[model samples]
Target: MNRLTIAAIAVAVLLVTAASSLFTVQQTQQVLITQFGQPIRVIREPGLHAKIPFIQSVIALDRRLLDFEASGEEVILGDQRRLIVDSFTRYRITDPLLYFQTAGVAENGIRGRLASIVSSALRRVLGNEALLNVLSVDRLRIMNEIRDQVNREAKRFGVDVEDVRIRRADLPEENTQAVLSRMQSERERVAREARAEGAEQGARIRAAADRDRTVLLAEATSNADILRGQGEQEAIAISAAAFEKDPDFFRFWRSMQAYREAFSEGGDSRLLLSPDSEFFRYFRELPTVTP
Candidate 1:
């Protein structure tokens, strides 16, 4: 063979080799290369790569996180309240081999699968709770359950779910009015009961006080009557004793007291005396009576 032909053949062989063994990957990507329809290389770094030309091809996939979110929907909480829930999720590809095998150069399929699984988890977990549970600290527990359950199923799809978050929860328009009305009714009923109890207790206390006062007044009146009767009897006994000791003097004093009691405040004072009369004979013959 001539040297020119030998050199030309060698050059052609080198070019074919270069073309078959060359590939590229990005910083956010992982690649799998197949030779004769069999996976022969798994490249996870971002750099230039080489593969068998014509008989080998590469499948590249993103290695970054993606978002999965659900539309707003109503759910019942643990307290029998209605809640509207909106949520979102964050996930990433954890197993490139499974991801490639299952999705095969179409990450959309994995995302779609994850969406279904996560949504189902959310519905199933949230359905057991009430609106108050969703609004309060208990939501953390429910969210954890949802994330764990979704992750359990999503591992089959080559996804590692990072977190689940609820955006909003709300009550339906029709239910708000009913809830408010029920609350008002309950408050009014409680207030009325309290007021009635207070009034009833007040009336009982007043009646008790009145009964005590009546008893006190009756006792006071009876005591006064007893004292007055005792005083009158004592006065009568003293007067009788004095009259027994000095009958004439007692009669004269009694007559003077009666005259004073019967007299008016202001009237003409009249006096009539007869020296020779029998009533004045004691004063006229005082010397003889003494003798």
Candidate 2:
């Protein structure tokens, strides 16, 4: 080889070696130094890290929070009700060395272990709770409990569980239908009670209205009787006044009124009485003719 070509080849070889030895770890990542497939040291702080070129290697792990979701599981609650629980977790690798030792620095391994821990914790914690609590407003409290339990266990795997959440907790289809039917029946019962109460109230109102109507009619009748008595008294006083004005004319007017009434269409029936009866005085007292 030429001397210039030899110098360029040596420089290129050194550059490749240097590049192989140095690796940059960003803020979101961590590195594990492994020699011959065995981890020796873990570099956590974000910066440039060096390893033996071609003899030792580096495995990068995410230091940032990671997400994992376990497959949906069926669990029986304290009330003997079955639920399908789908849960997710947020965690981070706090100890890369421990993680490397436990799961060989693979993200999948970490996720697998986390899934087991979360699943076990979820079952243990939720198994003791009633189904109502699981489906109720206290669901968040149950999730918090599961998170705490999982966090404690995940610490052994060099993980810090940030939070655990249940994405869905659903009853089996048959159970759901049963519950819906029961709820519908309960609502119908309440409706019936309300309708009965309304009918009772309506009856009371109608009875009260009838009583008021009866009272009004009685009062009207009493007022009418009072008016009729007053009218009779006034009529008697008028008759007395006319008698005082002229006794003969008053008597004649009374006789004429009696005769007209007795012979009218309403009282045209014959009467059996003496001809000399005073009722015929008007007829007998006709003015004598002077022929």
For each candidate, the alpha-carbon lDDT, in order, equals 0.81, 0.89
Q: Score residue 73 of candidate 1 by CA lDDT.
A: 74
TM-score of 2: 0.72
**What local lDDT score does residue 73 receive in model 2, on the 0 to 100 scale?**
89
Off by over 4 Å in 1: 1-20, 36-38, 76-82, 173-291
Model 1 lDDT on a 0 to 1 scale? 0.81
Query: What digit string (tens of lDDT, one per residue) describes model 1 on residues 147-183?
Result: 9998899888778988888887767889878988999
- The candidate maximizing lDDT is 2
lDDT for model 2? 0.89
